[model samples]
Target: MTAAKTETFTSLAASVLDIEARSVSDLKRYLDANFTRACECLLACKGRVIVLGMGKSGHIGGKIAATLASTGTPAFFVHPGEASHGDLGMITSDDVVLAISNSGETGEVLSIAPLIKRRGAHLISMTGNPQSTLAELADVHICIAVEQEACPLGLAPTSSTTATLAMGDALAVALLHARGFTADDFAMSHPGGSLGRRLLLHIHDVMHKGERMPLVNADASLSDALLEMSRKGLGMTGIVDAQQRLVGVFTDGDLRRILDQRIDVHQAQIDRVMTRNPITISADVLAAEGLKLMEDRKINGLFAVDDAQKPVGALNMHDLLKAGVM
Candidate 1:
């Protein structure tokens, strides 16, 4: 492209960004008692929150529905065109219908609004014009008005769509907080994602248990503990009392510290050179918590203990890395 054309394109892009940013900021004016009522309505909904829209608004509504679903609200999106044909059956008396239209006069959306009300479902309209037909028909109206479109022709739905999406996010997040939604709750809806792995995976899910655990009797020699660590390849070995309860942990770092002291590895008891009363996490705790514990302690390995303080499993940083928990 010519230099002149490139400069023109860059200037247009900057102007679009500035306009969209202001449009989103301008949405602050729309959050009133109605917004709270909308959130409270969704919170009290015994059925799903059904979102409806046409064209570009439909695309944005789908994303809004997905966000709400992932964040603890039960929601889904149905196209207005589809709703007119038969998809209106998806809504119920206990449900709440959220309709989106930039101009508030989308024919398809209007065609289904009365049927939705007749079905006993509450209606919430999101639009750029509050006085329009669809807005006036709603039990609650959220305005997503923008001063102007980013499209130079002023015919496209740029700034308006951005404001609508931001308003949707505001609603979802408000409901999320009101419902006491947590990371674990969010993770449940997204089990295939990385956040799910971090929030849902427990130490027992990745630790080496049973015969794979590296453990030695408290009376065992340091050399014996080293052999167990080498065999198990965990870089550490847990020391247990005669009752099979964990008493201490001997790691490669301890070996390094003791090497200069000239301690007799052959005759030294495992518990003598081990870290006494080491930090321990229960097997049922989240792997992410275990990772945080290890990082805070600056340690490379950990032992998962049962109620009796006996080592049930063992793991190191490498195992966490392999399990995608790091």
Candidate 2:
């Protein structure tokens, strides 16, 4: 690369690092009484947190609103410009408003401040300019001031936006902890996601049960067990005794080992070649736990046992992969 291009790239990188570092450091100054009051107000709010902003701040507010909603706080973003054009009706007396603007003087946000106050909603302004109109009119003000922007021109929202986003995350997580939100609650909110599948899908939900399960008697001949494994297409089969309780497991590996021993697959009994005391998982366990167990044991499959030690179901690595937990 040319020296001029290299110098320009190096300068940009240093500027970005400096801006982000200072933005994070500036957070310590804002985490005082004002931040405490903001958290308390949000915790006390019986309704949703209505986030409002304009331009670049509006984009940041949308992400903050989504983060809050997913982390146990009910929240939504409203464009300040749109709020004046009939969107103001979304705000009620019971809600809390979080207005974002780096300068604290964005015309759209300033225009809506009086109406937000008239609606009896608590206004919390996040801005770099504490003495500006929006901050002065707010019930609580959060300072997101930055020493400089990453842009060489010093006019972009880089550092200020980062600070605002981090502060919003801090608030959301604190509220999540105070509300005693659990993993199950998070799963409920994200039911269609992979996290929900990992937390909510149980072994029983994915295991092969009834006639779909592959099985063979412990006294059955090796040839018959091989037929069972082939018929079921699970690459393995459970070996049970007269009481219908699992005694051992026969797999493709066992077939290879028996062939290595020169044992007659047609004449040898499955009990003699099957794996005794095979590892099993409970039917009630989560699919995530089952996946972990398989990983730890270095096995591709496991039998699901009932409380009475009966072979209730079967599962394999393919099942977990298909379920999106792999």
Candidate 3:
């Protein structure tokens, strides 16, 4: 009986997923002139895009607003019920209103449709019914109709919500492209996010600078370089000439190689055994770029230098990990 129950559960789960997948995929057919018009409306919006919805659609609207805001479209979600209160004052003539309702008749959303138009704000509605009152009243109607709800009872909003969210993503991404939004622009909005760390965090930010960088004169003995490496706990050290300009790099990997060759760490000068013209990056280069340089060269550490090739900083794989740039 347990085995039978497992199969039944698996089959039901598969059916639900199938319904939701089709609900999203079928939206492509509905992305016609209305979708392009909606994009135009948002692209031309000078002030901000204000989103409205109620109930489950309200949750989806909030996510859409966040996505749009982060992706370069200045937007915020306003609960339709709140709009009827003093919140209506927030909308201006230059703004664009994006109303989401699976039923096309969420009373709270519909209640403010007329005022939204009266304020000279462009009204765009997303609804499951093309003939819904909200749809007729909108300057642009985006149909979010689905073949059926994933819910077996055909009552709860399941597949329809998924389709609505997907459509919202499509609209947001479309506008993001239209605006020529860049990774740097996105990072500016999400400074705390991982992508922001990748795009905004520079080598200098993650590198050990000044006294913290493990560095030694080129004439220093391998033992002296090793001591510096150990002191800094960076697994590597920079070898600099009398000019204090970077000449080479010595790493833990080189130390292992020297051990195999039986090179005397106490007797050998760093210049003779170190890796000359090692991979280097500029202080302003993105830490993500530094990571790629290390990964592509199959190395674990690097030095950040100025235009004059003087070592200004040093870092390794572990530093990148800690900086959240990985």
Full-model lDDT for every candidate: 0.92, 0.91, 0.94
Please report how far candidate 3 places residue 1 from its true position, in Å.
6.4
Q: Model 2 — TM-score against the truth?
A: 0.96
Clash tally, candidates in order: 0, 0, 0
Q: Candidate 3: deviation at residue 108, Å?
A: 1.4
* Tens digits of lDDT, candidate 3, 114-141: 9999999999999999999999999999
Judged by whole-model lDDT over C-alpha atoms, candidate 2 comes out at: 0.91
Q: What is the per-residue lDDT of model 2 for residues 141-227, given as tens digits with 9 covering 90 to 100?
A: 999888888877888778888888998898899899999999988988887899999988999999999987899888899899999
TM-score to native of every candidate shown? 0.91, 0.96, 0.95
Backbone clashes in model 3:
0
The count of backbone overlaps in candidate 1 is 0
> Which residue pairs show collisions in model 3?
none
Clashing pairs in 1: none
**Tens-digit per-residue lDDT, 1-326, candidate 1:** 89999999999999999999999998998889888888888899999999999999999999999999998889999998888778888899999999999999999999989999999999999998999999999999988889999999999889988888899999999999999999889989988877899988999999999999999998898899999999999999999999999999988998999999999999988877899997788999999999999999999999999899989999899988988888
Better of 2 and 3 by TM-score: 2
Q: Comparing candidate 1 with candidate 3, which one achieves the higher TM-score? A: 3
Candidate 2: stretches off by over 4 Å: 1-4
